[model samples]
Target: MPETSLPVFIAPPLRLPVRTIGRRTFDFSRQVAVMAVVNRTPDSFFDQGRTFALDAAVQAAVDAAEAGADWVDIGGVPFAPGPELSAADELDRVLPVVQALAAVSDVVISVDTFRPEVAAAVIEAGAGVVNDTTGLHDPRLADVVADSGATLVVTHSLAAPRRPHPRPHYDDVAREVADLLARRVDVALAHGVREDQIIVDPGHDLNKTTVHTLELTRRLGEVTALGHPVLAAVSNKDFVGESLDRAKPDRLAGSLAAAVASVFLGARIVRMHDARAAVDAARMVEAILGWRRPVHAVHNVS
Candidate 1:
């Protein structure tokens, strides 16, 4: 096999600190954080609303926390082939879940919504993180985050000229994504969001073909150069399905592999469906590379 070109930017040892869940700060030197996905929607791409009821969703969140997730991301809207919910509708669906999770678990709760109103509602409900998949299109979103004092994640999705279903048209995928994230970071900054409160996501599978997704994963280090923590959300995405020659539900193994690769490449945060598996893989890889702490000698107590 031909050798791949070296990535332009690899994630440096420097890890910028950020707050999550109301004043709880995280530093990357701690280890990779696994953000478990909790889709409350009945039409989500994977598992498709397996937890439709409030009780079920709450249990799911709790399970994720018990399973070693650093955070539980709750989303009410589905991203698959379905009609988009209006801002009010989205808020109505998501707020309850966020509130429920916050009520039960201290695990950081991230609300995934592009609507600023929805974001505000969830933040008010005690969500610790705001994950904007539209790359901060809603101007009020940054304000909501600032008011809530929560960390924000900005992700990339190409416009009409270069969307995934229609084949993304990018001059250079990695640099273009990096530039887009930089612009979104500027937007967040303009709205009074602190530099340390920001994280950047490359929006894997958002508007990219299989090749584009792979290229993004391979060159993730370049995108991390934007100078904020990088979050990788490639779990059970269609691109993984294509890469593995399987359906979305059957792509868990491939997703886990990609998640590990993302961490190896420089992703500080990995948004995933199977949190425990991903965490185990990351820990094992870290051990192999001697990234984990050395155990100290202990006296025998027999």
Candidate 2:
């Protein structure tokens, strides 16, 4: 009789899950969705107030949708350590943009905030996802998302929103991140958020050293194994900048490489700063992987 043995390698997901946001339903198994980043904060790390104005943010979102973005993640506050922003102030920044975009387009709108008040308000304003980068630090935010039936992006981070988590440490970066995300997902479920309405993010560069973020990226398959759609927000992240010794503006190639790697490893969604480029990269990756068909496949076919 042959002895039974444990598997040496884990297989990639045969198909990614599907999630509906706003008026659109994305089949991640057949598509790598592109989520454009539109920061409404003046201190945005990458844009630095480029879309801080309400008009600018609205226009950026519309352009991203036109450029093939499946979703627009509008953030009212920078994830980096910063002074606290009041809920009212955050509302003032993102609500109008959400309302504006909802009126004009069906592009899935997601708001990057962790405050319960802000989460509830935005969901009411037509936002479909609550991108909480704080790892459910305030569990009440989960309650808000649950009540609204909005998709909650459960992210991993060691500190409160806008607070510094200097010298963060992890035993196994990927495993730890997966564990954190899984726990947060459970917390969301316990608070009444459904399983299908949940997404997971490893939170690259959020309270993590470049080395930590790199290891997490290489081992991203573990996070995807959690059975929820994984979102990789690798656009212009410090990890890419530091790894290739490139400045923020020069990290485009590295960012696309990271995003592609994440998709290959089973990420169902990619959140990017460069919408058109990211959309192209994602489609190319999907075509190469046989998940998407070429626009013109007439080279050999008569």
Candidate 3:
């Protein structure tokens, strides 16, 4: 062996969280899960109403499941501070998809919403998890999840839903994100939510600059160290786009790299727009970590 100058990187031990959704329990440390995004909003940055129609949203969720996604995340509105959409309008866009998909698929149905009413309705419409990107701003959202016995994803965002977080600041972005997530997890517990039912996300690009998101991604282990399964929604995000100087449609490679990086740093669940590719990528990581075995070891065995 020749003298080496390359740095050796060792992955840290992951403290994964286990939770049961839709009567199925998932161990994050042992298995990587992909939550496919199906945004039923016309202003969605990625697809821009491609799946906004009721039938299209339903078909998209089904397609994601067939593509090996562990579940689907349905959203009615964009998180950006756009025009205010009433609860009824949000439900009209989301409920039909949830009802249609839940009636047919066992893949977990996760609804992305911060409003308590929307959360309640979706949970009733067969949603097993509420992907609240608001970091429990309402707290009533936690109540709805708790009351419905549904899983809750507490994502870190400084601003209220549909409100602009202008010129965001953080002394230490990673530390602050972790601290805020810890605080929000505590709030969920206080609101009668079960520990196993909670998940944390750093909310990349939601209210963060590209630099801040980069730091957070590099230091995601801190968030994972909180002992709740950390979810990274890095699919086609502006950070990935800006980091690689690629536009949204061209960010697949960056998105996979970021998603895999998050996995290396201890993220258990990856929310992605490209479900099939993400599922394949996640499984590859799982096999590399020895968390999952290869489907067939025929390369040498044969």
Candidate 1 vs candidate 3: the lDDT winner is 3
- Name the regions of candidate 1 deviating beyond 4 angstroms: 1-15, 18-23, 159-165, 289-291, 294-302
- The candidate, 1 or 2, that scores higher on TM-score is 2
Q: Which portions of model 3 miss their true places by more than 4 Å?
A: 1-16
Query: Which tens-of-lDDT digit does each residue in 1-302 have in candidate 2?
Result: 23333222222453336767778998776578999999999899999999998899999999999999999999998889988889999999999999999999989999999899999989999999999999899999999988888899999999877888889999899998999898888999999988888889999999899999999988988898888888999999999999999998999999999998888777878999999999999999767666667898889787
Q: Single out the weakest 10-residue window by summed lDDT for candidate 3.
A: 1-10
User: What is each predicted model's overall lDDT from 0 to 1?
Assistant: 0.79, 0.89, 0.89
lDDT of 3 by residue, 1-302 (tens): 23333222224344435677874678775688999999999999899889998999999999999998998999998999899999999999999999999888899999999899999988988999999888998999988888889999999999988999999999999999999899999999999998878888999898999999999999998888788888899999999989899988999999999999998887888999999999999999877767777898889775
Candidate 1 lDDT by residue in tens digits, 97-182 = 88877787788889887778888778788888898887876768899887777889988875421123465678788888999899
- The candidate 1 region of ten consecutive residues with least summed lDDT is 1-10
Which 10-residue window in model 2 sums to the lowest lDDT?
1-10
lDDT of 3 at 164: 94
